[model samples]
Target: MPQTNDPFLEIRPYHDEEVPAAIERLVSDDEFISAILKYRFPKLSGSFRWLFKPLLKQYLRAKWSKIKTVRDVQMNVASYMQSMIKNTSEGFTTSGLEKLDPNQSYLFVSNHRDIAMDPAMVNWCLHTHGFDTVRIAIGDNLLKKPCATELMKLNKSFIVKRSVKGPREMMKALGQLSAYIKHSIDEKQSVWIAQKEGRAKDGNDKTDPAILKMFYVEGRREKIPFAEYIASLRIVPVTISYENDPCDAAKANELYRKQEDGAYEKGEFEDIESIVQGIVGQKRRIHVAFGDVIGNEFETPDALAVEIDRQIYKNYHLFPSNYIAAGEDHASITDTDRVLFDSKISSLPEGVAQIVKSMYAMPTAKKSDFPIKQ
Candidate 1:
């Protein structure tokens, strides 16, 4: 367990010393054991949970016996990630990472797409290189289950309290979050956070200025200049491009429902289901592009957000699907790409198909608006 007097203990990831206790707790937790049974042995899990839970717990205990530190947990996760990539993706590639200094910690603000894969990909790239993996930022909304919280924290994820209500409570949570991020950077630990609160369902990747504002909360409290504070964090805008989104159809359906009904509601565990599908579903190719650190003078959050968006747009990799959706020709577009893109579109309703097409096309559209900086 974490020290009782630690202020950030509630939100921070588990310390190396706390890993053993956490692992033991997880193996013993009924919910966690049941979840494993359901995912791995679905047909038998519902009727035979009593039979499988104990066996699963024993298996997990034996499997995780050597995982005594946080680094051990991350290595285990990395092994699974490698297997998942091999099974679900054609290839994974990265750019601009070679330019980064492994010795320096950075704040990576990336465009959100998949609930979990965005940071996972970033961490994988950094780990494969000489750089240390980043501390991921995940929202509280995704942690309704205690087991989920344990699993995330075990993998170096910190909580962002998005569920906090009331203005005072919200402000307090934001302040603490900002302070924790700054503290991590000061300790030479890099952090990964989305540019906005949610995934860009519409495929339009824009940095919410409010997110930038939240980052400045601690700086403002200390009466520091905004530009200097921004520069100090070494903010790097990262763009993650997928040749095909695993949840594209679901996203399109939700958007279509919202357009017709003016509101859409999620099922109790829909987010969790999406996370699972994203991990296992097919993603043809993925590219992660790390942009230059923001050292320019920007006096306001909005200005900083604009620069971040520009970099994301410029660095975003345009896949064949994007070119096909945008009705543009590219040397990379082939007959196979056309057939695959068409199959995806044909699987959706006409209205939802248009939305999905637009979603894929937005990257191509936005690229023209923000040309690459020479």
Candidate 2:
């Protein structure tokens, strides 16, 4: 049930009017405070935070006292993002910004690589290139805690219903999602969503037709052709490539477990841990390429998906690490590149090493050797 008569109230990000209360609730939450202390000051928090909970609470309250709007939240965190980019990555490169019209809103569909970094990178690119930051689509699975939910919504991330059980509920959720996306674009707000539900652990990036179909679900209520509806949305395909994944070892282990057991179960805080690792870990180099918008030229979801996949693969920047994993002699790689890449995977166990190698290599194969589904 929504708190208001607005149809998207349940799933939409918090409004400007609600930012103050959401921040207050988040800072007051024990789970959030504990998570923050553990994330920011893990070494001393165990002994210090527990001993001085009141002091911690007072500090947080004063720090976040002026965060009364969504933009304020983004501005507050901008420095942290810039610092991470400065320290962790060699550099960030982007292409195709000149292709986009700044005044027009677009639906950016990108291949998911890292849980939080996928959208964060896209948003960063847009923000840096004089475009508005996009409203991100985040799954409900990551919003299990009240503090997590408030923080995400405050940062302009809307929830996607991933755990809906019944078919009817699933359909309803998708419909609402589709409607909200269309509404956002119509209102001149850009949106960022993954091409699939989860990150491609093995690095073979492909668009899921189900995700594309959801885009049409709400638009079909107007009795228009699917192609026309899709064209109206001005959908843009984006691809982001990381030279090195921060949670590569964890991702490899999970993939190996799935191969061995045919399924894998995740711990409750696994995603949060990955988020922390991704923020702090070394990425070496990063590239984001935006592709041309798919207009009335495509009629079916499969066709559209193939087109998106093609752009993603074609624009994916290959680093020395990718070629090294593929067992190719990199006559082009500098000495520093070789050393940095070697040190990244030097300590991995044999089995996980193979999985990590394949993860980096698959994108190259998809682009050159093997073709993704037609």
Candidate 3:
């Protein structure tokens, strides 16, 4: 993993000048950067942090009162999001969130494009439509970073644990997540989760069947039908795009290195760097588009899964690469189109071919061509 503290981590408050140097050393170790961040900055524990409790609680209380009603919370959240996008990025443009159903809770399953913008834009879109906050699922491994965990919690994020090494542990974690989802929806709220555990590079955004299976734990020989359990909460598939995802080249490198080996070598610092780059890197257009909603009104998990996948893939905006890549065997676009694109690539500098191929992992020729459900 890339060390995030490569002089950049010094941006945050540092009690000592040596703090950055130590962070650099710690981030460079064999251990995951997350483990390092956790060890160095563990979550507030026991009574020692009580020193600041009064002050922190006061601020939180003030923030809470300032955001009393659901409407207040939504507006506040949108303003915060808007300010963030404006400060760090060029600007964001979203379409289709107005189509969201406010009366009923829906599962906002989306393709993971930009890390920060994906969830932020989705929540902002929903908020504009007067919907309640959506619970977001982020990896527990990520919470090890000092500031990030606090921010995620503030924004209604729940952890997705990756350290469940045994089936028993995994089942328990899955059950806990399921129950949390139930709690959120029962309260007439929505949840947004990536279609898969991680972002799809190479442009394939298929929902993992295992993820779908994990969502239906309550249906086996129990009081609820699997279909009803899912239908009870509406699942609205959404698609997001970044004209330029800052991490695109990094992602391509990771994917290529992973293909060469089995996985990419990354530590917790890589996540930190990714977070920072995502927030501060470039000026690009961000778009959040909503797709159709799929519900338990269906009869089975298998059917529901297929339907949801169809919906999500439909809304995916396949940029040029996804389009031209298909021309190899797809008759919709002429080979002339592929040759023309390749000719443009040929004019680029050295190693551009490799980079281009990696960058467009799943680049789409067209984003609007995904299938619409019957």
Candidate 4:
């Protein structure tokens, strides 16, 4: 077990020593077992749950029995992710991988789209290209259950305390988070975190300067310049573009409801629904672009955020569907592109349909307005 007094005990991922207990804990949870079976075999949910539960639980325990470390868990799930990508996406491609070195560690700041797949895609790209998988940053709010929490930690995901109360506790949490991120990189383990706290529901992908400020929280204690401290972390901006968002329709519905009501309330299971939708829905093509590390060039958090945004905007891959939906001339679009765009927006209500179009078109518009810097 980890030392009882460890400062990071509240937020860190499960250590190798704690993996066995986590596995056991997750497998024995009736809610988790039922959820997984229902997700994997929805047709068998109502009357067949009794028959499916024991078999599924046995299979899960057997699968997790040999997993005694984080890497073991990742290696086991690697094939499952590969299969998910193959089934859900038409094709997956990566760019700017040559700019990275396997021996070095980086803080990969990515634009978040899907709750689970954003970091999963980045990790898959690195692992397939002969690099170590990154430690993912996930929010505590997503861990609605103990089993869910254990599963994420077993997959090398550390929790970010989003629900902490009071300024003192918040500051303390951020300091510990900053220290943990720095320590991971120093140990040659890369880290993947979103540019902001939540997904850009409006399709605008901008880095929050507050996130950048948090990175300097611990570094400031060492009395280092902001630029030097950021440089030490080797921050890289990542851009992931999906030709068709797997949850575009769902996101549009949420956007419309939020607009209609002063405040939109989410059901307890809304995030879980989104997670499942993102994994199983069709994505035409997905592209991941890795930008060069932002070294000691930016002296301020705003400056750093701007540079990261620029990189993401410049590197974002725009599909023909994007152009078509943005109301570009249909004459220039190919037959396949026009057909794809038509089918996507045909069934939606007017408001939701417009939101979906804007979601896909925003990246194209942003890229067009900004010239790529050499």
Query: TM-score for each prediction?
Result: 0.98, 0.95, 0.69, 0.97
Question: What lDDT score belongs to each candidate, Candidate 1 first?
Answer: 0.94, 0.88, 0.62, 0.90
- For each candidate in turn, give its C-alpha RMSD to the true structure in angstroms: 1.0, 2.3, 11.3, 1.5
342, model 4: CA deviation in Å? 1.3
Clashes of each: 0, 0, 19, 0
Number of the top-ranking candidate, with TM-score as the measure: 1
TM-score-superior candidate, 3 or 4: 4
Candidate 4 lDDT, 1-374, residue by residue in tens: 68989887878888888999988888789999889877878788477897887888789888778888888988987988999998998899999989999999999999999999999999989999999999999999999889889889888899999999999999999999999999899999999999999898878999999999999997898899999999999999999999888789888889999898866788999999988888888887999999999999899999999999999999998888778878776454789878888887998999999999899889878887668786
TM-score for candidate 2, residues paired by index: 0.95
Writing each residue's lDDT as its tens digit, candidate 3 over 131-153 gives 66677888777767555654455
Q: Which ten-residue region of model 3 has the weakest summed lDDT? A: 7-16
Task: Summing lDDT over every window of 10 consecutive residues in candidate 2, give the lowest-scoring window.
Answer: 365-374
Answer with 1 or 4, whichever has the higher TM-score.
1
Stretches > 4 Å off in candidate 2: 1-3, 45-47, 369-374
Model 4 bad stretches (over 4 Å):
45-47, 329-333
Cα deviation of 23, candidate 3, in Å:
23
On lDDT, the leading prediction is 1
Model 2 has an lDDT value of 0.88
lDDT measured at residue 200 in model 2 versus the true structure, 0 to 100: 89
